[model samples]
Target: MNAWNEKYLQVSLLWFAESARNKADPSVVTKDDQEAYLRQARFAQGFIREEEPDPPMARTYSYQQPHALPKVQRAFDRTYATRGTQREPAAEPFATATQSKHMDHGQPTQTTSPLAPQGRSSGQIQVTGQWDKTPIKLSFDPDASGEAFYQTFFQWAVKRKRGADLDRERTTLWLKASKATPDTQAYDLELKEDELEELWNTAVEWIQENKNTKAPHLYATVEMEAG
Candidate 1:
């Protein structure tokens, strides 16, 4: 009953009508035929006439184990503080004294705040506030009420500190309403594919980095609800 299935049904019906009208051929598709009926239909009808749409995507929830994420490599060199330049034992007693060149250990720079996330970590995370300006805001359609559900979820996130948790880069959150059809934010939610992909990808990458960091009992989620 996903959106893609509905589309396939439509295409099959179309092909059946066309074939019957033209008396192209008589055929029956049995369960054991084990052929892709939709593909056959498309091939017969010339698929270019009607492009296939992306199907209703299934996004399931997940909880990530506490872990570390790889830090973003900075283009510019970063400097860090070192405890009193403890000189290593001289190669030779008469070796000329020389300062040690800092070796890159991929550590954060000295100026980096301790709490500043180098990667996803465990424990309560501190966060700041900010507004996310939609690139092109869409006017709310009261009749559909699809968008309203999304707004409600956003508000819930703010109230429940989901937004804060996400900001801290310590959690991944995906808000998807379970649907038998490809709603694409049509009835219970509202979002374009690009936006959805961005959200989904961001959460996925967050989960990946957290796993790499290997924090403890870390939280990663793909939350679904009956909208």
Candidate 2:
């Protein structure tokens, strides 16, 4: 089997075995069971692979201009110095517009939905999101694969923050797409794990067919888990 299929099978079998063991003896684990679990864990480890750093092409694609990083870093430092904390939020860092009516009025007004009236847009989708109470927006090619969509989103998010590079592993990210209307339930989804490609595709399909007149707003949050 391919790497993806092999890893999936390994994880599935591991979980099934664990479940059966728990059901057989919820209160206690015999030494044999412990050894059995370790063996299963070792079996699963064969399918695992370590993550690699972003490639040179990825850096170029995401940053667009390498020289711009220095400027952004200087600005980030100034903001952090003034705030006396590294967690100072970026001021609409990913937004295409410096200021909008939404910022002026302290209320969210539709800045221009990227969705084509009849169906999916021919161009990139302008996704709007709020992070740390700061409004941000970014564009994505709807035609891209779901994995590409997820990666670009995270890369953009990390670039917009002050100290994201330092503690990225400790961080957990998630998205909550706004409700179609006041009466509808919102779409809440997690990131930083498996099944993300499916989730992203589902989100795109939802946006395309949603009943709302405009594209729904997206809210993103990043949390650092305690060590």
Instruction: Quote each prediction's TM-score.
Output: 0.15, 0.34
Per-model CA lDDT versus the true structure: 0.38, 0.57
Pairs that collide, model 2: none
Q: lDDT by residue for model 2 over 1-227, one digit each (tens)?
A: 46775776677677656766777576665777677667866655554433324323433444555565788999988987877744545544545365542375756566676765764454556566556654556656766876676576667766777434424336554444542334244454445446555566786776555423344444445556676
Which candidate number maximizes lDDT?
2
Which residues of candidate 2, in runs, are more than 4 Å off?
1-121, 162-184, 211-227
Window of ten residues with lowest summed lDDT in model 1: 134-143
Best by TM-score: 2
What lDDT score goes with residue 155 in model 2?
A: 70
Instruction: State the RMSD for candidate 1.
Output: 49.6
In candidate 1, stretches whose alpha carbon ends up further than 4 angstroms from where it belongs are 1-143, 166-227
